[model samples]
Target: MTKNITTTDFSAVKAADKAQSYLFDNFCELLTRVFMALEEEEWATQAAWDIAFGPSVSDADAAWRLVAFQAETVTAVQPLSVDDLLLHRMAGLMSRAVSATGIDALETVRSRAMHCIAQAPMATAAAVRDMAKEALSTIDQMLEHALVCDGDDMSVRALPLAA
Candidate 1:
C-alpha cells in the first residue's frame, strides 16, 4: 500500500519547554493506548499533541494528563507537565498513521477514539486496533454474502468465498 511516510528526531526535551493536555477526558483508555504500541522514537512520554492540538486540543483523543501547574490543594504529578513531549509525540504518530484513507477517516477515528478512556494507555491502544479489525471482518462477511446473492439470485456458489 502507498504510505505517507515521515521521520522524527528523537532528541531529549527540556522539562521547562514541554506542556501537557488531559487526553484522558476525551478518548476511551483503549484507543488512547495505541500510543503504547507506537515505536518510541520519542512517544514514550509526549504524544504528537503539538500538531494535533495546535489546530485545537479537541483534535486529540481523550487526553487525560497533568501539566506543569500547582494545585491549591496538592501537587502529585511528576515533573508537573508533559505537554511539550506529548506535543511532538502526537505529531509524529499522526504522521505515521496518516494514510490513503485521508483526513475524513482520521477525523472519524479521532471522534471514535474520544469515547476510549484510561487504565493502561498501551493496552487501550491495542484494544482499539482489535476493534477496527473486528469491524472489517464483519464487512468482509457481508460483502462475500452479497456477491453470492447478486441481483435476486440467492443461489449458493460452488466455491466458498469466506474461506
Candidate 2:
C-alpha cells in the first residue's frame, strides 16, 4: 500500500517536492516548445532534447526522468512512425492529450492546446455527484501533475490535459 505523507517521512516529501518542481519548471515549457516546433515543421528529436534538457544536461538523472515523463505523456499518446508525416503525428499526440481530459469539442481543444500551450487554469473544479464524479475526477486530474505510488516506485505523472 502507498504511504501517506507524514512529517516524519522527510525524504519522501523532499523527493516529491523535487519531482513537482521539475514537472512545473520543465514539463509545461517542453510541451509548449514541442507543439510550436511541430507547427513550424521544425521539430527534431535531437533538437527537442537539446532545447528541453540543455540547461540541465549535466544532471543525467533528471534528464532521464524528464525523458521518461515525455514518453509517457507526449510521445506515447501519438507516436511518430516511419510512414507518418511529422505534422500529423504531432497533431495526433497533442489532440490525444487534450481529449484525455474528457473535454468536449476535441478539435477546438486540440487547436487551443497546440496554439496556446502555456495557458494555465485549464480546468474548472466542481462538485460532482455519484458515478459522474468518479469519471470527471479522472479527467480533471489529467491537467495537473500528481505524485503517484505504484508498488515501490513513485513518479510525477501528467498529461497534455492542461492548456
Candidate 3:
C-alpha cells in the first residue's frame, strides 16, 4: 500500500518555496525600479554614473566584488574604456543578482545605447530612439520573466489546496 504524506510535510515545502519566491520577487522589483530610473530622458548621463557608482552596497569594495563575479559575460563585448568598463561591471553585478542571460543581453543593448548617445549630435533622432527601444525591450523582458517565475512558484505552493 502507498503511504500518504502528512500535511506538515507539504506545509514545510510550501514555506520554503514561498520564501524563495519572495526573495526573487523583491530582486526583480528592485531591478525594474533601477532600470526605469536610469531610462528617464533628463537623467541619461547621470543615470549611467549612478549605475556605475550607486549606493546599492556598503562600500566600493563590496560593489567591486559583485561586479567581478559577473565580469566574464560583460567583458565579451567591444573593448571598453575605463569608464565604460566600470559601467559594464555595474551592469554585470545587477544582472547576476537578477537574470544573468537577460541582463547580459541588456548590457549589450546598453553598450549600443551609450554608443548612440555619444553620437547623438551627429546622428538622426530616429537612431537614438531605436537604441533606447532596444534597452527598454530587454528591461521589459526581464521584468516579465521575474513576474512569471514568482507566479509559478506561488501556484505550486497553492496546488494542493486548490485541488
- Compare the candidates by TM-score and give the number of the best one: 2
| Residue 2, candidate 3: C-alpha displacement in angstroms | 21
In the range 1-163, model 1's lDDT, one tens digit per residue, is 8998897644435433331223322122223333322222124124544334441232221221111011100122222233222222332223223221333344443433333222214533453345434323322332333333344232222111111
- Expressed as tens digits, the lDDT of each residue in 106-154 for candidate 2 is 3343454444322322341121121122222322333322112112132
Q: Which candidate has the highest lDDT of all? A: 3
Q: lDDT of each model, Cα atoms only?
A: 0.29, 0.34, 0.39
lDDT of 1 at 132: 39
Inter-residue clash pairs, candidate 3: none
Model 3 earns a TM-score of 0.26
lDDT of 1 at 134: 37
Which residue pairs overlap in candidate 2's backbone? none
Residue 105's lDDT within candidate 1 is 44
Q: After superposition, how far is residue 105 of candidate 3 from its true place, in Å?
A: 12
Runs in model 1 deviating more than 4 A are 1-124, 151-163
Cα error of candidate 1 at position 162, Å:
21
